[model samples]
Target: MVTGPAPTAARRSVEEVRERVAAVPDPELPVIGLGDLGVVRSVATGADGVIEVEITPTYLGCPGMAAITSAVRDVLTACGHPDGRVRQVLSPPWTTDRITPEGRRTLLAHGIAPPVSPAPDGPVAVEVGGVPCPHCGSRATRPHSPFGPSRCQSMLWCTACREPFPHLTAL
Candidate 1:
């Protein structure tokens, strides 16, 4: 039998953490996975496999923190890791850009248009120039109110499609 050197404690490779966190499903959207939502920001390992992770939520007020944390822990535990630390950061805020292209496609396929291209360069309206409805691909959508489904999204209805859709509000 051949044996390899024992792995020493150090910040695990970003790739390792990604593979772990990527599988961690979002409590709200179990099908969409956390990695798809672009929530898994930074993952680092310390002595004793003390993993630290930073995540950004789809919405600042999105009420999935506790469940999300538990989900992350579950993935870690499954990976033979016992101690994992997860943290959520609001700085820089969560934006569509963080979301992977695959995630966006997934969201759209699910009938929710991921915010319109991200807020133009700067100092722009959250939903100006109109947001396209991921449902029917119509730009003729209007905000029903300041808020719609969640803080991250506003209510928008498509006149052409005659369907209500969620528009991700750019922060």
Candidate 2:
């Protein structure tokens, strides 16, 4: 009887690598996957079986980049791609617009307000106005601080709920 070769770890495809990497969570935002956050740009596997992943950070000098990179490597290695490497792409830069709808929902559910989308006509005009409060869904929120615990987040206080929440800054 003739039988085909058995599937092996070495036979892992680029798609498989991508799927595995996609499941990797963001270091700072554990609730959202890197894929949902639009951080993972592309995944490619070389003939030598080395997998390379391209990623774009939410902003330059984002402290979580190093952690995110390490997590990607760990995930890839565990998925049988021990030679996987993550490459950061900063040419085009990252925008809040890149965030997936599911990611936005996740952020909101996590009590962090997602960045407002840029106006269709042009870029959103930055105004000193109220940002919707994630806790009470009130537009009576004010910026408590221009900065939050993380670089990409802004601290906001909701007048309705009298609570402070993080708002994802628009890039």
TM-scores of all predicted structures: 0.75, 0.84
lDDT values for all models? 0.73, 0.86
lDDT of 2 by residue, 26-52 (tens): 888888898988899999976776889
Error of 1 at 149 (Å): 3.2
Candidate 1, pairs of clashing residues: none
Candidate 1, 1-171: lDDT as tens digits:
999986634544556766878877777655577888888888777666577778887776789877888777766665555477778988878777777788778878877777546354777665544677887787888777677655566778888888987665654
Q: For this target, which candidate reaches the highest TM-score against the unseen true structure?
A: 2
Worst 10 residues of 1 by lDDT: 6-15
In terms of lDDT, the poorest run of 10 residues in model 2 is: 5-14
Q: Find the number of clashing residue pairs for candidate 1.
A: 0
Predicted model with the maximum lDDT: 2
